[model samples]
Target: MVAAYQKLCPETLDGACRELADRDPALDRIYRERGCPPLWQRRPGFRTLVQIILEQQVSLASGRATMKRVENAIGRVTAQSLAGAGESGLRAAGVTRQKALYCTLLARAAMDGELNLGRIARVRDHEALDMLTAFKGVGRWTAEVYLLMALRRPDVWPAGDLALAKALQAVKKLPVKPGEDVMRTIARPWRPFRAVAARMLWQEYLCRNRAASAASG
Candidate 1:
C-alpha cells in the first residue's frame, strides 16, 4: 500500500482540490481563497522517518541541512550507518542531543526489524498511530504527519500542531486558537479528507500571513 501511494505522487493538486471541493463547500471556499500548494511527497523508507525525526521543533531549512550533513557523513541515511555514528558525529551534523538519540534508536529498530513502516499503509489510522508511536522518538503528531503527508491518508489530523491551530483560527474566524478537543470536534465534518483540508489550511495560513510566507520564501 505504501508503494502504491508513493506511485500516486506527482498527483496534481488541481485534481485533489476538485475532488475535495465536490465533497465539501467549505473546502471549496478554502481552495478558492488559497490555491493548493503542491503536495510535498517524500520517498518512503527508514531514511525518510529519520528525516522526520530531524524535523521536530525546527525550521525546514535547518532540517534539510542537518539531513544533508548526515547523509554526506554516512554516504546513505540507513539504519546501519546512523546506529554506528557517534553522538559527537551526529551533533556535528546539527542534530539536537535528544533528536540524535531518537534517530539512533529509530535506526536500531529498523535494522532489527522491530519497525515495519511498509506495513503501515495497510492498517487503520488508529492502529497506524499506535504502531508508529511505539518507536522511541515517535509521538502522535509525528505519526499523524507521516500518515497524512507520507502515507497520503485522507482523514488524519495533528490536533497538537500549533501551526494548524493558528491556521484554523484565522481561516474559520475563531476568536482564539482552538484547543485540541475543540479542533477535533470542528474537524469532524472534514473527515475522510481531513488531510486535504490540512493542506488547504496551511496554504491559507501562508496566504493570510504574508510576512511569514515571505520569510519562509
Candidate 2:
C-alpha cells in the first residue's frame, strides 16, 4: 500500500515530466527549453511546516529570509524552540505579527501532540491534508504544498497559488492570469501528474521573469 502512492524521486520525477509533456504543448516547451524541473522536496517535519506558513501571502524569498531569521533567533526550528520563542520572539525575528501568532499556535499544536507529522506521512493525501489544515495557519494552499513538496505526492495541485496563476498565464499565453476555477479546469488534463506540470510552470515563471528582469535592468 505504501508503494501505491510513493514519493517522487529523481528518476520518477523525470518520468512524470515526460508523461506531462506528452499531454501538454506548453509543458513540452518547458521540457525542451528548461530541461527537467527539480524535485524540490522538503523534509516532512515541523520546521518545514513553519517555513510554509511563513510563505503565506509573501514572496518565496521573503519567506525564506524570515525562516532564516527564525532559525538564527532560536537555533534549531523545533516545536519546542518555536514555542519558547513565542509570538514576540518570532515577530522580533522578522515574522509578521499575524504569522507569528499562526506559528505559535502551530508550535503549540505540535508540542501538545495534536499534530503528528510522522503519522501524517503514512496517511492518504486527503487525510494528510485534513490533518495539517486542522492547525490554525495551515490552509489548503499550505497543506497542498506540504503534500506536493514534503510528502512528494505526485498528483496534488495547489489551488490559489499566485505563482501558478502567473505561470499559467505566461505559458498558455492568456491575456491575464487564470482564476481558481479556471486554473482547476486548465489543470484537469494533467491529472495524476499535475504536480509535475506545476513544477514545469514554476520553472517557466521563474526563468521567464528573471530574463525579463535582466533585460530591463
The TM-scores of all predictions, comma-separated, are 0.85, 0.95
Over 66-112, each residue of candidate 1 has an lDDT whose tens digit, in order, gives 89988888788788899889566798777899999888888788889
**Per the 3 Å backbone cut-off, how many clashing residue pairs does candidate 2 have?**
0
Q: For this target, which candidate reaches the highest TM-score against the unseen true structure?
A: 2
Name model 2 segments beyond 4 Å from true.
1-4
Each model's Cα RMSD: 3.7, 2.0
Query: Positional deviation of 79 in candidate 2, in angstroms?
Result: 0.6
Assess candidate 2 and give its TM-score to the true structure: 0.95
Native-vs-model 1 lDDT?
Answer: 0.77
Q: Deviation in angstroms for 87 in model 1?
A: 2.8
Candidate 1: list runs displaced more than 4 Å: 1-26, 211-217
Q: How well does candidate 2 match the true structure, expressed as C-alpha RMSD?
A: 2.0
